[model samples]
Target: MRGKSSIEVSAKLKHSFLFPDEYLDWANETENNFYVESPLIYEVAFYNGIKALKPWETIEYIPVVLTEWKKVKLEIESKFEKRDAKGATLPMRVGIGLFLELLFWTNGQPVELNPIIPLESLKIKPVNITERFAFILARPNLFHSYKQLAELMVEMEKLYVKSIIVRK
Candidate 1:
C-alpha cells in the first residue's frame, strides 16, 4: 500500500526497454498514454495478436457466424429428446463460445452482407485448420509474470502500433 503495486512498478521499469523511442513519443503525442503505460498491455496485445491471425484475411471480410445454442437446442430437441433427454452431450453444432474464439480480427473489412442470402446457398462446413485456442478471459496467468508479460509486449508492440496508428 505504498506508491505502486509490484506489477505496476515492474511495468514502468520494463516499458523503457519494451517500447521503441519513436513509438513512445508517438504514443505520448497521440494522447494514448494507456497504450504505452498499461501493465496489462502485453496480455492484451498478445491476445489481440492471436486474433489477428485469422485464415480469412485474404477474403477481405470476417463474418461473425453465431449459432444461438438454446434456440438450436430447442430446434433439435425433438430428435434427441427420446434418446438423450438431458441434451448434456450436444455437439459443436450447438452454440458454444469455442466457435467464437475461432474467429479473429481479420485485416479485411467486415462485409455488409445482403439480408437475402438463402441458408442453402451458404456452405456448411467445419473449420479445416488446426490451431491453438486460448479459451481463458483476460486475467493474470500463473505462468507469466510481469517481466515475461513485458517481454511479450516488446515483441507485439510493433504490430499493435501499426494497427492503431492508422486509426489515429
Candidate 2:
C-alpha cells in the first residue's frame, strides 16, 4: 500500500457556486460538483476576467479539503473509541497551476502567500458568501485530451495559483 492510502485527512471541501445562506446546510449529503448543477454546485466559477478566470491558466487537482464524516461513538474492549467508522465524505481543496494555452512562454509569477488564508480573496465577494473555494480556468473542451491536460497540470504547477471561493 502507499503512504497516503493509510493516512486520514480530517477536513474536506464542499464547493458551491454561491456561498449558501445557512452554514448548516452547507454540508449537504449529495455530491456538489458544479457539473452536477444543483443550484449550489457550479462548474466554472469566475471572478475578474483576469483574476477569477484567467486565460491559458492550467491547474493541478489537489486535495485541499476533507469532507469529515460524522464521528460515531462506540465502545469496544472496555474502551471508548471514536473512529472514521461511519459515513464521512469531503472534498480535498485543490490548488491549480496557471499557464496560457495560447502563449507557451511568459509564465507568470505566483503571489507568495507567506501564510496562506483559508478565506480566498475575490475581487467581489458573492452576495451571500460563507466558505471560500477555487476552480480551473480552462474551457471544458481542453480536458478531453491527455496531452493537453498534462500540459495544463505542468503549467499549473509552475504558476501555483489557488482556486476560487464559491458560495451556495
Candidate 3:
C-alpha cells in the first residue's frame, strides 16, 4: 500500500540526503500511511472510525520545552561525538552544512562552516520558504517531519542566542 510506495520512494531518493539512512528511514516511516500524489505532494487522510472525515483544524503543538529540546539535541550530539572515530560526525556535519547552504542560497546570504570550530560557535541560520521548496524538490518524503525538526532546532538556537543577549 501507501507505506510500501513511500519506502520505495525514500530508498530511491536517499542519495540526495546528507542524513544517515537509518535516521532518514525513521523519519520517513512515520509518514507512510499518508497518500502521496507526487514526490513533492502527499495527502493525509483522517478518519472518525465511522467514516472518513474532511480535515478541519490542525492543532499546533510544541510539546517539548526549550530545555528538553536542548537536552535531546545534546544527546544526539554526544552520540555523534562518541562515534566520531567511526565517521559519524561527517554525515551530521554534512547534513548541517547542506541545510546552511540551502539557507544561504535561498536568502542570498553568506555562511561559513568551519570544521575546526565547535558547532556552538557557528551562527544560527533560519530556514525560509525558498530553501524549503528546494528541499521538497530534492526529497519530498522527508519534507514534513524533517523540516519541522530542523525548524525547531533553528528556533531553539535563536532562543539560546536571545537568552545570551538578555543575560549580557
lDDT of 1: 0.26
Which one wins by lDDT: 1 or 3?
A: 3
Poorest stretch of ten by lDDT in candidate 3: 39-48
Report per-prediction Cα RMSD to one decimal.
19.9, 19.1, 13.3
| Residues 1-168 of candidate 2: C-alpha lDDT, one tens digit per residue | 311111111112122312222132222222222111122111122211111222213322121111110011011111212322121111101111111111111222222112332223423222222221122222211222222323443433333332223221
Quantify all predictions' global Cα lDDT against the true fold: 0.26, 0.21, 0.34
Report the lDDT of model 3 for residue 41. 17
Across 50-155, the per-residue lDDT of candidate 1 in tens digits comes to 2222222332211222223234334334434454433422321222221222122222221111232122332321222111111111222212222232233232
lDDT of 2: 0.21
Q: Give all TM-scores, in the order shown.
A: 0.18, 0.19, 0.27
Residue 161 miss distance in model 3 (angstroms):
14
Clashes of each: 0, 29, 0
User: How far in Å is the alpha carbon of 58 misplaced in model 1?
Assistant: 6.3
Clashing pairs in 3: none
The order by descending TM-score is 3, 2, 1
lDDT for each residue of candidate 3 in 1-168, tens digit (9 for 90 to 100) = 223322222232233333234222213343432221111111111111112221111111112123334544454455545644234333333334334333332222323222221223334444453455345434433324344545745764564456446656
